[model samples]
Target chain A: MSSPVNPDFLILAVQFVVAFAIAIVSLVGYRMFGSRTLFRMALSFFLIGGGILVQDAGNIATELAGFGPELSILGLVLEALGYFVLAISHIYTVRSEVGAEVSSMTLLLPFFAAAVQPSTALVLEGVARSVSFFLLLYILSENIIFLVKNRNAEALLPIVGFALLLASLFIRLFFVLPTETSDLVDLLKLAGFLILSGPVLVLLVRLRGGPP
Target chain B: MMIVSDILKVVKEEGSKGEGARISSLLRKANLPYNRLTEITDRMVSNGLLEVTPQERGSIYRITPKGEEVLDSLIKFEEFAKAFGLRL
Candidate 1:
């Protein structure tokens, strides 16, 4: 018997490795800063990253279980929901520094929305991706303002990292919108990973110079 | 301690005139000079003690809550240090 081709499985396997690395490095970054907010943001990223890994892993397993596309969509929705929470937490973190303020408890908005509509993967994924994009923008703008006001190398790193991260979201949106083939989206995700991960690793190194 | 000294120094560093010398006034009360009091403020901006607002040449520095806390801790330490006869 010819071995069945599993595209999602292959995609997830690659994503899982990269995402896992990002998560671990960010964890180390936050620990170096020793700031409460940075630590929380790192944890949120780890959760989202790990959740995506699981969602992909689950998608592969479901195919092995003879599950249909509908069940696989459910996995995507869960992953998206996880990403939504991650985005919200990240926004709260950057916003808090400037006293703009967002309640931590309000993160439930996306989580509750996701739980209510687990079946609609497209809708949930769109909402999650869009919000993450906006949050990345919000964070980037704040960092820019900070850089304008402070004009320091320290501030520049986060601004540069987050700007690329926001750009990555645009790439992601293109991938998600056309859903015709997974190839483009997977490539976009890899690009997003590079943009997001590279800066974070640099940030982690910078934080090491500060007092823990 | 150092954070307070940094705030005072940054305030003085911005200019030699205006209410900026309010920090100088306080340091004067402690018999500290605007020129010699450089040890603490240099580190405060980096330590997030004071918010450094950059201008054309120098920057306006304001004390943060972290700086305030450090000042309070310094004050208390000084009081205790005086009681123990350890000259500050």
Candidate 2:
């Protein structure tokens, strides 16, 4: 008899699909804009998607062997690196003049944290999450300032999107919800991504009507 | 380095005024060097983002429909960039 599919597998599949969609949209933006910042963002999303797929595979392997979350650390590290790259992309976006110096650093924090002290993995995860949170906050504040100075209505979209993302990150960092409500954080994060995707998709559609 | 988007913006604003603009006017408005402006305008023309016509005094440049569409997209890009505290 065929075995029943694992629910976790289904969840991972959905995550992979969303990540892939984000990466694809970012890639299209990169091509249209020819901006290195957009290129880095696309690469960041691709890494996140790859991390999800790897994590899913690791989960299946561990489940089959009766192991725990040990192997899943690989995926976690990839995700951390992805976030670091995302931070770098934000840096590039803010300071267009800095090029080679910005792209040179290779993020090894996640891997080092995983390899050197497996027992402190949670702490390392928290640290990485904190870094990402701060970077996102920086981005959000910049957006707010720009909106205030320019009074551009279109700027509101990204401000709202980044605010949602900041909220999700804040919840991840500070709140410890019960199992019943834990999924709320993930849903908020997903909604944040969907919100950010709106401007990107709109740009893509506009590009469709223009020259290649 | 001057961003291509800035050059596009200058061209777009000048072109949208109905009458085509002279290269000197574009240079002053775009705040770009002669060589750089020529290079960008050439590329834009080949990309169908601009239309160039020769007149008695000098060449006249105007934004095509494709150029307007691109400008609309660039405005969106500018919004995205400004959200990150960057210029498009």
Candidate 3:
């Protein structure tokens, strides 16, 4: 007598859970290390996780279905800001100050793009692609270095996942609104995030004081 | 912060003995330069994570209880970072 489960909602659930889990662990990293890098990363993950749900809000909630375009745009903005923070975390070089300058400088752009002008959505989308692509590349480079130094075959998971995500980003530069292209992007990111989560699981255990 | 944790770890390891650890010995064990060690030590002393006892030869450093707590957090964080394929 039970109805079938919706796969979209299921995927959204998994993404939400994983993103928030990583965000929580990274927040703990910020607390322990007192580094702006971890703080920004935590903020980015939180935004990305929340953005996933909000972007698909219409899909999940029947009443909100009519607000799809606006909600989706807002979600994109949130996700874009998430990418912005993530890229800043990777590339930011200023260390040892109170971090007021860094915080003010890095966070302003996404807030404006997200809140000020709807017309900027395209720009915001493009910027999101750039930042996330760069972020993946940076992490991939770090992963490669780690592998070379430690001979860790484990590093390949995130590397491959990030590579797929990177390829999707590259594809997006050409086909922005194609249904199949977006679907491929979604598939790649899901696979990427799942694989990347394996490494983060170790971090989560360390953060929680469990045996690693 | 990583340096602070590293210094605390070294001090705790080396200075847990009588009268704590001397600066020269700390320099050798901590792998940090002299001026940097002293500067960070001074700050750690001020922050209450470390305490100093003045002696005729020089000041000796020891880890405080607060330093132990901070060291725990920092070590866990460092391990987490390592797991995530980072040096810091």
Candidate 4:
């Protein structure tokens, strides 16, 4: 009966769907075709759990508690690893594209450190959480450079998803605070989340025909 | 990239050392139950992992230098596993 365009609410919905798709893909792919690397599988589970937890925390804080202050630090930590996994997925695309191999050793260090040390894990998680933002920024800058050099709207589509991801991260990082953050910041965060997650899912479907 | 194990799997099961069967015939003879011989040969060539040389008589099939290195590594892994009392 209700329309789904209330910005923050829409972002939450899209994030949930993206998270769900990621979980399914990770589960099925690892179970079927993947190398069955224990560490990487664990990482995938961590990210999926983090995504679910973040969504849950946001819901509890916003609707039930009305008192928002770190209801789910565990979720935050998991969310960090989730983004890191997503980053790894993007990196792995290089395997298909260039036929290059990254040593399994290179993949293990960051995850092992993230798992054993909480404080260090927190810092790493924070950095990893910021990845989509940086990727969006990179895409934006690159698109601008390309537009100036060659002027193509097609160069901008990939950045659409990156922008949405940046928006959601910006909200989590700067806006979703106690009671004093700006309404404008909150608005931007919600808008960014919806744009990044939902449109990116569509783009990925069209471009990759499924989740990466 | 194909692993050494995969290559050795091919070589060991499909290896044949007979004259009069040209390298092409040897390649045709070297297929597993489920392999695509042509694609495998293309891969073998691209990776510098297999070679065929034409002699006065007929072409000879030989593992390339790098292919030999890979085969040697696979053999070493096999020996190490055996020494460690592990079976796979």
Expressed as tens digits, the lDDT of each residue in A75-154 for candidate 2 is 65565566667666555554544573544353344345445554665665566566557656666776677678878665
Q: List where candidate 1 sits over 4 angstroms from the true fold.
A: A1-18, A29-33, A68-118, A125-127, A130-134, A140-181, A200-212, B1-88
Off by over 4 Å in 3: A1-5, A58-64, A93-131, A142-157, A171-185, A207-212, B16-20, B25-39, B46-48, B64-66, B82-88
- The candidate maximizing DockQ is 3
Off by over 4 Å in 4: A1-11, A22-52, A58-71, A95-155, A167-189, A196-212, B1-88
Among incorrect, acceptable, medium and high, the docking class of model 4 is incorrect
| Cα lDDT for residue A94, candidate 2 | 48
TM-score of chain B of 3: 0.87
Clashing pairs in 4: A164-A196
B-chain TM-score of model 2: 0.84
Q: Distance from true position, residue A103, model 2, in Å?
A: 11
lDDT of 3: 0.68
Lowest lDDT 10-residue stretch of candidate 1 chain A: A203-212
Ranking by TM-score: 2, 3, 1, 4
DockQ, candidate no. 1: 0.04
lDDT by residue (tens digit), candidate 4, A47-81: 74555557556545756556433434456556655
Worst 10 residues of 1 chain B by lDDT: B79-88
RMSD of 1: 12.9
Q: For all candidates listed, what's the TM-score of chain B alone?
A: 0.55, 0.84, 0.87, 0.49
Judging by TM-score against the true structure, name the best candidate.
2
TM-score for candidate 3? 0.70
Judging by TM-score, tell me the better candidate of 3 and 4: 3
Q: After superposition, how far is residue B22 of candidate 3 from its true place, in Å?
A: 2.0
Winner on DockQ between 1 and 2 is 2
Question: lDDT tens digits, residues A128-198, model 3?
Answer: 55555655666567656766777766667767866776786778766656765576677777776787677
